[model samples]
Target: MSIEIESEDVIRLILQFLKENQLEHTASVLEDETLVTLNTVESRDTFTKDIAQGRWDTVLKQVSHLKIPPRKLMDLYEQVIIELVEMKEHSAARTLLRQTEPMFLLKQHHPERYLRLEHLLSRSLFDPKDAYASGMTRDKRRQIIAQALGSEVAVAPPSRLMTLLEQCAQWQHQQGILSSDADFDVFQTTATVESKEDADALANEIYCTIKFPGKNAYAECSLFSPNGQYFVTGSVDGFIEVWNHSNGKLRKDLNYQAEDNLMAMDESVISLGFNSTSELLVSGSTDGKIAIWKTQSGFCQRRFSPAHSQGVTSVCFNRQGTEVLSGSYDKTVKIHGVRSGKSLKKFTGHASFVNTVLYVKDDTCVLSGGSDGTIKMWDVAEEACLYTINPAMNSSAALAVQSILSVPLITDQVLVCNKSNRLALMTMDGKVTKTFSHGKEKGADFISAAASPHGELIYAIAEDSAVYCFSVASGSLLGETKISDSELVGISSHPLSNIVACNDDQGHVYCISSK
Candidate 1:
């Protein structure tokens, strides 16, 4: 059985929420100290009945605070005034027509109706039952009127806090700080944005710069968090650092030191990746060590020591975050379960050092590139090589693949870069569909590359410290911005905004804005 109150109010609903959740002491304190309240309606049933039964006096007394439109109020007045005339209460009907401001406007705008009322008054006769020609009873007419005003007077759903946070999330997404496809927990996360309106499309200039702690530390690899709040960089000096997204400051709090006086791995860091939610981050080192850290606390949650006999070149987590996919100079790719701390499967047959590896086709396949100038697709379940991509066989390029990048939010296509004079977009198989090239007679090869989250633009960093921008659809060069005198070795694009983080071999990470 449900009990009914006169009406719902904020404080009472809050109290009910508190008490229902076993927060009696807090509820008591809230009830005793509460001053804020919702705009309350008393006995909503009786109030609605007064309107539907044509008790205009009662309704008129309560309607002012509802803030219903003046036009609607005028219609209500006309209904009652005509009913009074039908009831032979001419003086009462005339008072509303001439005295009330809304009724006065209605009379001025509709002279013919006013004239009919005057004629009826002159005749001294009318029918109360036939006040409306639509044949609706007076009671039914009032019910219809009440129904029309139902939305205006009815109380809105509670929990203004959630509504406000949801609105904020939506607005931030529209403002381009949060991508239209990404959202955040407003209660726990504040939208930290350094975006400009013009930069929403592409980035051309360096926005800010962050240098590693040591002058000689080179950032070998970099990547952004999924939520776009932070980005992590792997340096040649055996340190993996995380930085704040909106500012170029180091997030020292996320630097977890496993042992006393130790900051990172014993060997130089080579690659890095964030799990789907950014809850965990996995770092691969030059000496074939892999460390998974709790992102929030920066704790070394797990490690796979000597996962490969040589340097771990690239690393990422499966979408479920339960498994890790890694490639190494050992010329092998392997999947390791995070919980069991065991190697699950290994794919072989790359003749040289594997440069990169990633899971594709819904985590059922492994794709890898190698220094031997070939890219191989392997079936994850069967541990068999599906196909290999050798660029020399299909194009006039001098090399195969140095890196393979997945276009964010897009499946079936990935960006491929190599020592060749061209960059191409290829499918999960070995077929190339689009290629990007330049006529600047040069021997500078692309060391690293990243694509826009929506697959609109491509940012490839060359060994000459030049960042080339290319249109994904047209395969045309949009522009190029040189970042440093030193060779830029790595690049990472923001997951949501038009910002790219590129790092040089001399230890500086430049955050460039599309605006």
Candidate 2:
């Protein structure tokens, strides 16, 4: 058993004694002389630093003070035990697993992991590393774990007080208290300023809008290029168009197929995705046809229809961009070679239409959500459904997952949006860690959702024509903006900016930017 003592507590106690002895000035002097900070280490940066340095003890010392969930707490203990095992201190590791309160609970909750640890105790030195290694280093693994745990720890944004003061000063100046136009420091007591910029960092109004109307031109899906250079939308009219992300200008010149802007496919485009470089885009169609287009030239690169009895609902490229993963209305997920134009693997299990699909867990697994109100994780090589998450079992009944967005930089998590009134951040193993609600009580169905470039925020467009922005770390609703008086749907976040793209049923796409 171990205990933590805050060193600052002793410093504070001395200061308190001084103040009680009626030596306020001396107490202030002593505070400055010692240069003891109250508790800045509770900040997310410090906690993450401790984790990165393999100081799991320091992190665990702060766990009770912070609001880390139980599962995350177990992760820290697991890290400690794994490290001890790696150091070849099997006795110490076994002691932790058997004697520690947290590990005792972990064994009861995660028997398989406990069993695996027991097996590791008997395996060779190199054997235990397999559970955590895959061309990844110790530092990188710690970094990933620290990042995942950092969100659960409460930390004020760096310089938050100063930023809020500046914003308040701006608001006061805009209200005519500070009248001078000359630039000056916001902290200055006597300076008067009139800056024409707003302090709100979230988009409140539409910045740029695009209107397109033709035969079956309703946009079914949209995606922003990973480079933040282009925003592309797939339409029911069988046409796909690329637009300048900043200006919303349609590039008709890129299409080499027809002078009249010939369609990308003969059937309705249902889903769209861009490769890591944004150079190539894949679109799935209602006729089960999949096509790849070169983004820069806007020319069709490859087209094929195979292995699906119905329309393709979603398509995404693996990290290598060499193969495509797709889900379809036929209630199946399939992988196809980008160059070979042949079906590579098929994962069949969903009892209803598959709504979304993506390769997760370093592309070793395929994760898909279906209209059957279930999310399934499949092993790519074995072609077996490893785990299934049912919405009803998770306390949200009658909800079908409409879409899934991968949380940026957080490898093991994804944002699952449902048709009912909730969206959740879930683990690849089917654990819902955080759930955000929409249209509460009366219930509003989310049409499409997207995460901010860094996955710090979530944006979901509901059938009510309003877009809701949420804080991913805190699971709080940040802001809500009505995009159209009509029906607004489909969301795609810019890869590099504070901009997000969404479209209405009338084929009118709107780009919203920071206010």
Candidate 3:
């Protein structure tokens, strides 16, 4: 097999390589032939020449034209003025001080630096080295300006050796030969241990606590938008509330009605899931109805009444969000088209209520976990069970799988929660890789489980109103957070942050953060 490389991409790579290696002539020739002038090269050259030759006026003019950040530009201005002071060009430095925006900004934000520069202008016969306390040489200041401009304009800096090493590491990572968790920070060389530690620490804090509106009914399920800005909760009173998760503001309230009266019991939303892009939300209700809503408008765009014979326990959207999968207490899983609002396919294998459903293997298969102590993988196109997995039985009590989550950043592995206090990380083939148990001391019974955005940690809410954290790599108990006094019902993790949200049976929602 041969790889097809785009001509533009190849040209970009070669030009970048030549420029980094200082082969200016070769890079110029390639640029001319390809008619592709790099976005940063021309501006960088002009800035470099102006700074090196002490062309203060020209440098200021170019700085105004470039899209340099305010802070960086201020630093550049300070360096240039210091250079002028060292050279005893007081008149030139004064002109820059009055004319440049950066100098004025520095005066407003960093008055100390500005006052020092002003004091240097009063010196008549001072040593050049003593003009600025920093003692940064003229050549060093020029280099700093060059690097800042290159970075601001998206130009690759002069570090050919480091660049080559990074390329090798990237290739190794792509080939699965380099473990991402390796000791050496090949990909993130500039990241410090403190930053990583801070990130890991964010997994332990409760940042936001949101209380639902209903006095008697509590949230049964909750889901975060794929972008993590918003979250929706389904309540026992058949009301779905959308919230701005960052600030705990109620965005919309979607109420279900039964002939003008508020619907309860079978109409209660038991499970909710967001589509891949977060544009739509699919909800499964106890009344065997599946509804799709426009996330922005909170309007039910499509509804499938009597989608199942009994309560719909779990609902999920396919990768495209064009289809929805739902598991029901009716003992079956059904797939429905979002546009047509018609049942497209149904799989029947579980001996008990199907609690959770998800798309697997590029959405070609469906994975469902039932109270019958088994998981069944069904072929979407064939409409048949492809395989069944019975996890290792640890007790004589009937095994009722409560929830299933695809392990974040992991392939063919899922986190499964059962009626008992234990959670299992198992492969699609049903092999248990690790088991996390909530010791009897806590008296915590698993209600649901969620994996962190990066799959490094697994979070579970138990009967004791506490959230338990487990390390996915070792299945060790990392920590636990007591979120409420009422029983916790549902939990979800932000897609891109170390934030987790859990709702309790008392209409309270707690947003836990690692920070």
* TM-score of each prediction: 0.64, 0.59, 0.60
Model 2 lDDT at residue 217: 64
For model 2, the run of ten residues with the poorest summed lDDT: 191-200
Worst 10 residues of 1 by lDDT: 254-263
In candidate 1 the C-alpha lDDT for residue 284 amounts to 93
Best-to-worst ranking by lDDT: 3, 1, 2
Residue 47 miss distance in model 2 (angstroms): 69
Off by over 4 Å in 3: 1-202, 252-266
Clashing pairs in 2: none
Clashes of 3: 5
Best by TM-score: 1
Off by over 4 Å in 2: 1-201, 252-263, 392-396
Residue-wise C-alpha lDDT for candidate 2, range 1-515, written one tens digit per residue: 11234676566556555555688788768767877522323367888999999986677676644445678767777877788888898898888788877778789999988887777777767453555657867777788779878876554445444555678667445422343454656466334323433212455568788777774467777888775556788887888877665566675545443345444787888899899888899999998889988877666788876547789999999999999999999998999998899999999888889999978888999889988889999999998999888854345465778888787766788888878667888887778888887546553578778877557788898878889988887888889898887787688887645678888888788889886
Kindly list the per-residue Cα lDDT of model 1 for residues 182-277, writing each as its tens digit.
334455443433344322366887878987766677788888888775588878888777776566776654434322223378889998989988
Put down candidate 3 lDDT per residue, 306-405, tens digits, no spaces. 8998899999899988899999999999999988989999999899999999898899998998999888999999999988877635676667888888
